[model samples]
Target: MSDFDIKSFLTTLTQRAGVYRMYAADDELLYVGKAKNLKNRVSSYFRARGLNAKTVALVSHIHHIEVTVTASEAEALLLEQTLIKQHRPQYNILLKDDKSYPYLHLSDHNYPLLAYRRGKKRKSGRYFGPYPNATAVRESLNYLQRLFLLRNCEDSYFNHRSRPCLQYEIKRCSAPCVGHISQQGYDDSVRQATLFLQGKAAELLRELQQTMMAASEALEFERAAALRDQIELLRQIQEKQFVDSGQGEADVWAMTDWQNVLCIHRLVFRQGRLLASKNYYPRNPAGDDDTELLAGFIAQFYLADHAQEGVPKEVVAELPAETMEPITEALRLSIGRRVSHSRGQRGQNRKWLVMAQENARTGAQAQVSGRQESARKLEEVKQLLHLSDAPARIECFDISHAQGEATYASCVVYGAEGLMKDRYRRFSIRDVAAGDDYAALEQATRRHLTRLKEQDDLPGLLLIDGGKGQVARVAEVLEELAISTVALFGISKGETRKSGWEFLWEAGAATPIMPEAHNEGFRLLQWVRDEAHRFAITGHRKARAKSRSQSDLESLEGVGPKRRKELLLYFGSLRNMRGAPKEELEKVPGISKKLAEQIFIQLHGE
Candidate 1:
């Protein structure tokens, strides 16, 4: 047994529906399971009693577990199947074939019947899907039947019908056999249903919108409302079916780094079905860009002797063509076959790429969730700082600005439990010289420390994103406040001004300590520093954008703060206000006809 911290992990585990993956000591995925409540389900394996020999063996080897939350149990089930099929973990009962996968079959009659099917596609006029399961297919079929009123009856039963069936009475079928609907009308319904099945949502929505408008123009309000309802239902379906698509073949590659752990996920599609997926964690010693990493991985992957047999005809990623060109050329030469590389900017390819990216991000997060890695980093921090015990809480501060405008300082909190986002604070630097980072840091630190002092709740260590000068300013703040419990350090970029070459300055120390590039403690510090920088920069940009967005309105004559607020409130946005006609502008409260005309003329430059 690998001493898995079941009790501690369970404390943070959520009671939501999700998929949980169990891993062994070597980071080998052993099992994947879905649960209605993640906390209860995962806890069952570690109970004190009632374990079978196989279950005991599986639990004994468990090192850590990771979870991906879903909105509902159905979604969790679907994602569970996806991960199971992709990884085929040793403890999972793998499906030997795609025979059990369900599909939506549209028959060849005048009023084509949409029905749930499995196994062979011999009787199909069009097979829309190999949906994850029969339930998903049935749900889609039920929705489509309601939206388009397409029939769902056997051919023999349809041919012998003398009048409308119950399905037709319920408005789920158009009853083409009894002439309740014209052939032209039934064909149009079939065409619309086809568009929905094929995942041409945009085109289908456009046609629906046009029909709704026509109905409105003819004063058929009831029909227009019904069309509107149908459109909404179609949109809902689209949101749920983001991964659903028609026939295609390609391989998707995505890479992501989470909590300093890098993961790359590859998804393979054949005949529009997800055949397999796998994850890789290549060492990123040089901290390469994603493009460089992906290019290298793709080249090495396809050039491998065993990989040549499964080389896809097309490869899709979130990389540009120029970056992938060399790899594509190399593949052609080595394999004597042409392979296309795509960015997957739109349609089904984009969806596949997005899914791959999401999986990569989640996989990286899972790897980082392992307690051993986190404990190692914390232990390194304790040794580097010469502390008797590992610090439970560390806070980092950074200042950001554009030349001399929209100055903001950000504080990010980190602890054994990972980032404490709720504890993060942003200070809008005031009464300080613009671009004077020292002043901003002093003000931000004084304010943050004052609050912490009153509450008697302070972090174990404080980090600043600058050198001795910045550290001195913060030290002065601590002295003025008469606070001495927290240790303080400042990190400054080395001469090359790159990551992995930062010099750390202790409070009141003249000399800076430069740790080795690969030190875990230094890496943890870098991650915290980078996070503070990102948060500060993001806050600064939002402040700058808000100032710039209001600049135009502020400059307009007779538009004081109150009037500007009213104009924005009434029009919803500046763009809408600019486009509003004078007559509409006059309708707003407190805007006279003369003022409205003047406003229009100024807005239009007329």
Candidate 2:
């Protein structure tokens, strides 16, 4: 499997903390990792217990490696991420996709407008959050606007407004758009808003009290009354937020997983009260135990922009003591302080940690129950379908095409746990006529049958997403492969157009087996059929798009891929090049005056 001489590389590696990059046979990066000792950490991968199914698959494809030695593990951690960004290795557990978390940006203006923002934060504005979800930010923003009469209008809208808008009429804004509130009054409101968002509500309340008292002494009764109303609103907010946890501020991190899929939940707390909670899902975590996962996650997560407000005073987690020590030191170095990172200590700290753990555990248990429920449905399917063997592994096939173009066949697999996403496959129908479903099924079934190396690998039941005609064709192919043990059935959404009531039939059978809408057996069948249909549509659409993109350039006899690529790169896209004049087209590196005219005519010709 592995062509690379890993043992010889092991001899060459030094016992130093550094980053190591692993490459696959095709010189593709499989994984990039950092370790306390390069030799020991890299050596452990060859050990027996360290190999999981995912890692084994990765290891089998390894070709060669590279190394960059760092002075410390922390530096190595930073370098690992840099290399990951550079290569995006298949085996590494990446931080997150490029989809950025949303935040609440308050503009730095005459009357600062608050709005939900997504993307890189600019330097000028005051941003209050890296909130978990849009709903949370919107809920908090809604209340913040109500409690403090701050402007939520756009800068353009505010600058051009002829009069106060509905926000002012609803008493949500101070009408600063039309100068209803003075600059000084608006500044005071913004200052309080800043304090409240900074998790310093008490400090804001005290400042409001002082302002109200001064207004009263100056005989400004109207101003004092308005301040009193604001103070009451702020107090009402505090009363709602004040928790009875009897603990100090700490950010709690807990992990829960099912069947190798893991989710880490982070709860940010202020004054013993939960401020915000966010969940992070790591696709197929590499750690063998909970401790390793916790330690690695702690290192990677804190190093990123996850902790926007710097590090919390205490880092509460349910990690092992051995795992905690080194991670704690790394965290201290990052935070520029000696942070308390421990778990299951005592009192309210324990209570908070336990609560977070419960959240994680409950989340994990839900995953387990969901899978178990699916398994039960499979069991019901076996009994209802009258099969000799349990239908633990079910395979469904579907055909998708448009009249006479871009025909595709999709095979979706389902196991006892649920949908086996990794085992899904799509085949483009070549020999079969474009709209012929029966011929398409026969061709796709033959391709799938050849891949079955062992009897155990064969599906317990085979389902076709058509009537008896399609089922009969698949059965003929199965007979050609001499695979008779696997049961065969056909599923058709009848003319009723309802989902649950599907007609099921055996191979070459005329009569349809009817199952109730609420039956778990019918539900399981429906799930598999729907997945097959979706997979077929996705494959068909992608194929059709590719055909459209390729045929456009390939239609020109003289325009080879190299020349077409050059022209497209210069023009930016096919659509752009269609309108480009021959003069502009000739500007491309490889195009000639004669060739450019031909391409121009080929594209924009009547």
Give the best candidate by TM-score: 1
TM-score for each candidate, following the candidate numbering: 0.62, 0.37
lDDT of 2 by residue, 1-606 (tens): 564655545543555556677777776778988886887988888887858888778777877655544334543554565557556777887656565877888888877887778778974689876754444456567778988888887777888998989999998998987889999989988888888988898677767777877998999999887776776566434432112233477888888754333767676666554544445666543436766776688778777756864677878888877777886788778767887876847655665565566445534433433445557767788888887767868999999987868999999997765666668999999977768888888888898887883434888899999887888888888888889888999999888978876899898677999988756687678878987998897777667868888666666748888997766445445765664434456656789877977886666431
Per-model lDDT: 0.78, 0.72
Q: What is the Å distance of residue 423 in model 2 from its true position?
A: 1.2
lDDT, candidate 1, at 198: 84
Residues 1-606, candidate 1: write the lDDT tens digits.
Answer: 877767556644666566788999998989999897888999999899999999998998899787765434555666677778667899988767655768888888667888888878889588876766554567667888889888888888988989898998888887888998889988988888888888787688777877877998999999988887787566545544322233677888999866567888887776665555567889887888878988888888888754632888899988888988888898889879999988988766876786677667766755654557667777888888776777778899999999979999999987765666678899999998978999889999999999999999988889999999999999999999998888899999989999889999999887998898878798888988998998897788667768888655664556667777657545545665564434456655677767776776556433
What C-alpha lDDT, on a 0 to 100 scale, does residue 292 get in candidate 1?
A: 91
TM-score of 1: 0.62
Error of 1 at 230 (Å): 3.7
Candidate 2 error regions (>4 Å):
1-371, 453-456, 550-606
Error of 2 at 436 (Å): 0.8
lDDT value, residue 235 of candidate 1: 51
